[model samples]
Target: MNTTKLNPPTQKNRLITMILAMFLGIFGIDRFYLGKWKSGIAKGLTLGGLGIWWFIDGALLLMDAFLHSLGKDSGFVKDARGQDLRLGLSMYRLKDGRLQRDWFSS
Candidate 1:
């Protein structure tokens, strides 16, 4: 059996979250940002799990926007400047950028 402990995904960035969901989100980009690793990859290749979950997938992103508007600021992360940063949620870039991983995610 896998030893990974399943923790609730972390939320990150409002605008960036919306953009990711708006564009690459259909392929699980948003979930990946929220730290839902398995779901991200699956949704990415399966096109929101065969497109049947299109609404549900979109809801995930909408919920983030809704929550942010309510000042539920958990998604905002701190940057090197010690200010709340609106960073995009991405595992990789399509071009001219680097990919990153969260070693502690699992």
Candidate 2:
């Protein structure tokens, strides 16, 4: 078995995901982060299913982000790029084969 320690994930920024969903949700940019392309496309194609789907999707994202804000995991899958989200400040990362804590913080 090729066992290796992957650096812990960046602290999945709730704010960033929420902001993306609020603005570019129609384009599924927010869904891109959660690796939810299927639903994202559906919303984008149906014009948010005449607004209903859009609202629901936004609400779900907001709820998940809020749950995560309480120092708890939202249980959502990791972002596809596994990169830092600009809106998700206070993120962490792996650098030099080690953990980079608070990567975006000053």
Q: What's the true lDDT of residue 8 in model 1?
A: 30
Candidate 1 deviant stretches above 4 angstroms: 1-11, 71-106
Q: What's the distance in Å from true for residue 81, model 1?
A: 22
Each prediction's whole-model lDDT (CA): 0.53, 0.58
**Candidate 1 residue lDDT tens string, 1-104:** 54444653243454665677667877877666656678778888889776755556566556644443444434333322333323223332222243333222
Q: Kindly give the stretch of ten consecutive residues in candidate 1 with the minimal lDDT sum.
A: 87-96
Tens-digit per-residue lDDT, 7-65, candidate 2: 54454555767777778777777676667688778877877677776677678666554
TM-score list, all predictions: 0.47, 0.54
Against the true structure, candidate 2 reaches a TM-score of 0.54
- Clashing residue pairs, backbone N/CA/C < 3 A, model 1: 27-44
